[model samples]
Target chain A: MLSFVGLGISGFESIPIEGLETISTADIVYLEQFTSPISESDLKKIQDSIKGEFKLAKRWLVEDGNEILEMSKEKNVVLLAYGDPYIATTHIELRARAIENKIKTHSIHASSSLTSMIGECGLHFYKIGRIATIMSEMKSLTTPYYVIYKNLIEGNHTVLLLEYNQDKKFFLDPKDALKGLLETEQGQTRNVITESNYVIIASRIGFKDQAIVCGKISSLKETDFGKPPHTIIIPGRLHFTESDALKLFGKCIDEPFDNSEKTEKISNQMMKKYVPMVREALEEIEPLYKNQKEFEIILDNAERYIKDAEIFLGEGRDENAILSIGYADGLVDALRLAKGLEFKM
Target chain B: MLSFVGLGISGFESIPIEGLETISTADIVYLEQFTSPISESDLKKIQDSIKGEFKLAKRWLVEDGNEILEMSKEKNVVLLAYGDPYIATTHIELRARAIENKIKTHSIHASSSLTSMIGECGLHFYKIGRIATIMSEMKSLTTPYYVIYKNLIEGNHTVLLLEYNQDKKFFLDPKDALKGLLETEQGQTRNVITESNYVIIASRIGFKDQAIVCGKISSLKETDFGKPPHTIIIPGRLHFTESDALKLFGKCIDEPFDNSEKTEKISNQMMKKYVPMVREALEEIEPLYKNQKEFEIILDNAERYIKDAEIFLGEGRDENAILSIGYADGLVDALRLAKGLEFKM
Candidate 1:
């Protein structure tokens, strides 16, 4: 009998109860190390938990001719893999060999990285297209960039998992990954990862220290995203609520402007053109109120319009903000029309 | 804060370690009854383990209104669900609402029916395709049959999960499911389910008293498969080694005819027509052996061929059996061809 067990994501605690049981009961256990590596502490814990001796095998043990076939002939063997057993193609080939040798085989499925932690970033599962892995030395590799570019063209959100080295403590952050993607796009004449292109960077998923930060690709270069096992998400289209959530929780237009002091000096010149329009509105509304009775209500109405306009402006929608500003201008026009009608004063 | 927890497939022991932690930390825990149900003992164990009150809600709590939303405002509410949190659409909708309302939501994913104890049955996970649940009243429902039909047409194996009623313990057995499928196919113009269709019926899966029986779906109707929580699998295609494994571990097939009881009646029967062919092969091969030394080798070869032919015949391969019989015939013809070239001793 051959047993395939998924070690789950995160650590040994993440493994399903049944998966743990299968590993403990197996006679000969072999772990596939290519898909995802378990932590050394977790690996030691699994060895202590299981009765059998666990052996780690490379991709060649299962793929090479007759190794798996000979072992599967008589003795009971168990193959340990990260995430779900059938998630990788190596396990699939091993299953086909076990079937060909007439050996009984079974698999204990567990939570895979593909499906488990994706919900943490608030991305819909069905909307995800092709998944790509970005390496640190990716300039020599063109395949990964092409996959992400093609998936984006199809209007499907692409999830790019950045590679990490635990021993070296060198992990590729989302900003670095976006930089690689930007370089690739520039070379290909595709200006997708621009300063305005929104990207979501999620760090330490499935852990307590998990963080989700959304911003433009250019702005992410200056952001400090802590920790490893980061994933970069490029959203295809934003729903209304998603856009609102991004504005509220994520970075909007409140980013620091470098030329704010210089812009303040020119504020008087800009204000001169709009002062007459502002003064005319203020003059028209002063007489219409006549008393402090309706003053609070009018002020509240104006406050709501200003708040709505600010939110619209923060989303990089100057035209939509103009519409709201026009609504506030109509209120002033109505006050002017009311004053011209000769109200009881 | 709102937490979504998966209860796993089995009783309380089946729940993941992380799920137990979420339940202990939650101020208010609510279980959705539609997706999965918990045993009374397990539910009581959970209630005793946690300090908070555990409440049960129907689909309406997740879908209809913001009852969960209203409770999660100030309380650290946790929603207990069956399987993984995102497997069902209701949980996904609930999570989306929690995110929209700015309520912090966490998901503790666990094992599901999709990862049930399939290892004991000796079936590979990659080989199994889209799963279909066989309801108790399958006679009135066409959904299960259609799913099975589609899976078969797509050349994928289907795992049929027999649904059981918690109140009445009314579960559909694998034999009954097979009969239901056969009847459904008969009702249609196509006769897909035959006496030779290989079906695997596993009863009491994940339990110690698990039983796996592989045979024709028609033959399984008569076999006694004890206990509940049965699963039926219909393999689309068979590889050579899979056929061998089935012959070795699965149910045995009865012979076509018996000649030991009445030799006189067998001699006069239509089955006697093949006796001459068997005799001619034995007579020619007997001449090749001058003593027991040569006769032993010929007898061993004949015995092995007969065993292989029997396995093929039992698997409903009369055509392949005829080919084996022809090979035995060729052995006799070779002896005849050799005898013609030799001088009589």
Candidate 2:
């Protein structure tokens, strides 16, 4: 049997009670630290507590799991990892392969930084949307940029996990990650990330030296967030209780504010521009062809559609609002083009 | 001083190593099981392990927090709860209050069922979107229904936490939750939930008899989920590995398929109907306005807008697509109305 166990977030001390016994009793235990680096003291403590043969597993060894599977066939083997073991797709795949090979597999789930950091930062976990990862080698940060945009418009917090390459002993710095996001805002221009946007940097969560610092991006520009394994949380809407909790729990360089307030949804952005523009265009063309029966009918439809558009927008039918405004704009523009007037669309 | 420790998903065996020491050495240990119920065996084990004064804390005690906060001012009080402590908003609020009172606070993060259940079901944790809770007393399930709809369109998994009323010993059954979603579909008509929709009911996770049963809602209608603390998972897109892992790790009543495939995005749904309808409308009125010079400009613009709408939709500019199509329809309709024909919108 092959057992997968999590070391949880706080290194040796956060491992589940059952996981301790599983590692001690196993014939062989392979500790994988590629997901997150472990401290020397915690590593020593984990080694001293285990009675089994201990081997450090690299990322490739866990991914290419022939030796682990072969050993588990005859002896009890345990593969331990940082955070919840199955959060890594490679671990889940390994478990599936073990089951297919007729080897019994067991999992011991432990605390993950993904879930832990939110609470440590005093943020509600339920409000977290789809998580995004920022790799240092990526050509562009558009994917994660839009992720934050979508989450913001929906009033959901976004958790950004930075790249950690264990082989290179490299961790993506939080400052660089923030800079990348700010740069992405230049191209996307969705008002998602700005200098004044509030962000929380959760550094070394679940550790004794864990620190959570929050402020606008500009204020945090000169701030130094010590240590590796940092996460950035861009909160959307904030309940009063949440803001209070954040103020009491973390180091605040500035008062907490909602980032979602600045980032408007695309449909709303369209409506904001077109609603007034379409109405003005209709007013401009109204007297030009007033007494003509067919043109008057077109003008009447344009005015009605403009009114309908505003109602749809207020009712949260954003797509319909945009569509209605566009139609009205089209009607007025068509008439202007036929009469050789200035184009409004 | 006060400490908040999570008992993790498993009962006594799953507490963090640090958490166990904190509870054992604390002056008072208040075990709150309102979030989830602990088994009798686990309860007995927990009581035996605590060397300090052990007290059972009800929901009110935790929510009120005055007693605990007062005790923490002078005594070492620990509030140990099932799953991760901060997952409950009440705990976060209490922590905030403790901080406001100048009481030192500590947290020992443990495994959350929120993250664990996703892995246990062989689903990717990052794919999880915003979570929704379904209460038995809710007047309508429309809120959760739309949440599922939004998550599905984004190809993200939805985790539906069932209502657990600890005082009444009442837990919303997984079957009832599923039925409620189906009923919600009748009014919402978003194709988010139906008899044919696939779902997974994770029952008593982290326990000995934990079962992850998944299939179509119709197939699971007669399934006896055995116990309370059940959670329903509505998976969006299924990666091949995810499907294979689910079939191997859980009881599969039917073949795993993408729930997202059946549920189209509202924008896409709009485009599907409007694009073709506008094209048909344009075709019918094209020849009638062919010779008329002023009306021909309108007809030409209509044709261009229709084509632009299709291109925009294909490019994933959904709002733009809808706008373009609506504009085309209005142009065609305006010309038809002038000629005493019918309306297409």
Candidate 3:
């Protein structure tokens, strides 16, 4: 039989009661630290409490799964991991493989920092959107940048997890992660990440020295976040209650503000530029073709479509709004093309 | 001091080891079952194990918080809750209040069914989008219906939590929730939900008799998903490994398939209908202005813009695609309107 147990977020004591008993009785217990590394003192305590043969499983060992699967066929084996065991898809796949091989598999789910940290920061969990991880080797942070943009527009908080490498003892600093996002904004220019944006750095959650610091990105630029295993939260819309809780629960360098308000949707961005540009182009062409009866109808239709576009945008029909404005611009520009005026579209 | 301890997803065995110690030594332990119910056997085991004074904490008592918060000032108080204590926003709020009242507060995170059921169903946790709840008294399921639509379009899985009223001894049936979504599709008509869509029903996860059943809505119409605590999962895209795991881990009456493929994005949906319609409209206008020199430019530009729309759409610029097509349609229809023929916008 194979058992997957989680040593919750806060070191050794956070392991579920049943998880403790499972690891104690197992013939072999493999502790995997690739997800999140445990402290040396906590490691010693875990080892001292275990009755079985304890082995530190590397990332490849768990992923390869040959020895663990083979041992579980005869001996009672437990693969103990940090956070909820299955948060790592590898463990989920391993469990599937065990079931496929006719092995009885058991799971003892424990606290995960993913679910724990939100409450720790006093943010409502239901408002969280799809989480994105920032890797140091990525070409651009565009994917996660857009993820935050999308979540922010929808009034959903984005939880940005920094990359952690246990083998090299490497953890991406929250500052570098934010810096990458700011650089992305330079290229993408979606106005998603700015220096004045509100962010929260939740450091060492569920640990004895846990700290949450909330402020604008500028305020945190020089602040020292003590340790590794930190997460950055970009809040979208804040309820008064949430703001109150955040103020009471964490250290505040600045007042909490909504990041969603600063970031405009792609449709809104286009409308802002094109609406006035189209109107200006139409004004220039109207005088040039005033006496031409055939051109007069097209000019009138163009103005109507532009107005309709704004109304559609206000109604939340974004695609239609963009389409209307684009059509109106095309109409005006077609005349500009015929009259040898500069094409505005 | 007040400690919010979680009982996790399973019965009594799922509480964290430290949580167990805290409850045993506490002067008062208030077990709150409002989030989810505890079985009689588990309840008896918990009562027998605790040396402290045990009291049942109802939802009102916890939300009101006067009694528990007042007691914690003078005694060692632990508020025991089902699954992760903080999954219930009320518990999070309670903890916030405890901190505000100058009482020390601690939390023992446990297995949340939110995370547990996804793993149990062999779905990747990172692929999940923002979660939504379905209350029986909700005027309509539009909120959850749209939540599924957004997740499906992005190829993210959605976990739908049903309403559980402990006071009334009631839990919303999975079928009823599915039915609500189906009804929503009829009114909205974005093709987000249908009878042929694949879904998974996860019932009593982490319990001894945990069951995960997957099939199309049509196939599951008469299927029995036993027990009070149940959840419905609407999967968007299926990676081969996820599909393999699902097949091996759960009982499936029908082959699992991606619901996202059938539901086109709103832009794609419009393009499908408009591309052919615009082309047909352009064809009709060609015969009327074949030799007219000035009118010929408008016709040529309209045809070029129509083709450009398709190219832009194929390149995944959805908004630009819709705008191009709408522009083309307006250009063509403007010519159609000037002529004695009918307008085809």
Winner by lDDT: 2
lDDT of 2 by residue, A49-131 (tens): 88989999999999999999999999999999999998999999999999999999999999999988888778898899999
Better of 1 and 3 by lDDT: 3
Winner on lDDT (1 vs 2): 2
Candidate 1 on A99-149: residue-level lDDT in tens?
A: 767788776655555555545544444445456678887654355555544
Residue-level lDDT of model 2, residues B53-122, one tens digit each, is 9899999999899999999999999999999899999999999999999999999989999989999999
Off by over 4 Å in 3: A276-304, A335-343, B283-304
lDDT of 3 by residue, B95-180 (tens): 88898899999888888888888888889887888899999999999899988988898888999999999999999999999999
lDDT at B216, model 3: 95
Query: Just chain B of model 2: what TM-score?
Result: 0.98
Q: How good is the docking of model 1, by CAPRI class? A: incorrect
**TM-score value, chain A, candidate 1:** 0.63
Q: Each predicted complex: what DockQ? A: 0.05, 0.75, 0.59
Sort by lDDT, top down from the best: 2, 3, 1
lDDT of 1 by residue, B63-170 (tens): 763878888889989988766666565676677777778888777776554444333333444344446677866444366665555445434456777776645646
Native A-B interface contacts kept, per candidate: 0.12, 0.72, 0.60
User: Candidate 3 docking category?
Assistant: medium
The order of the candidates by TM-score, greatest first, is 2, 3, 1
Residue B12, candidate 2: Cα error in Å is: 0.5
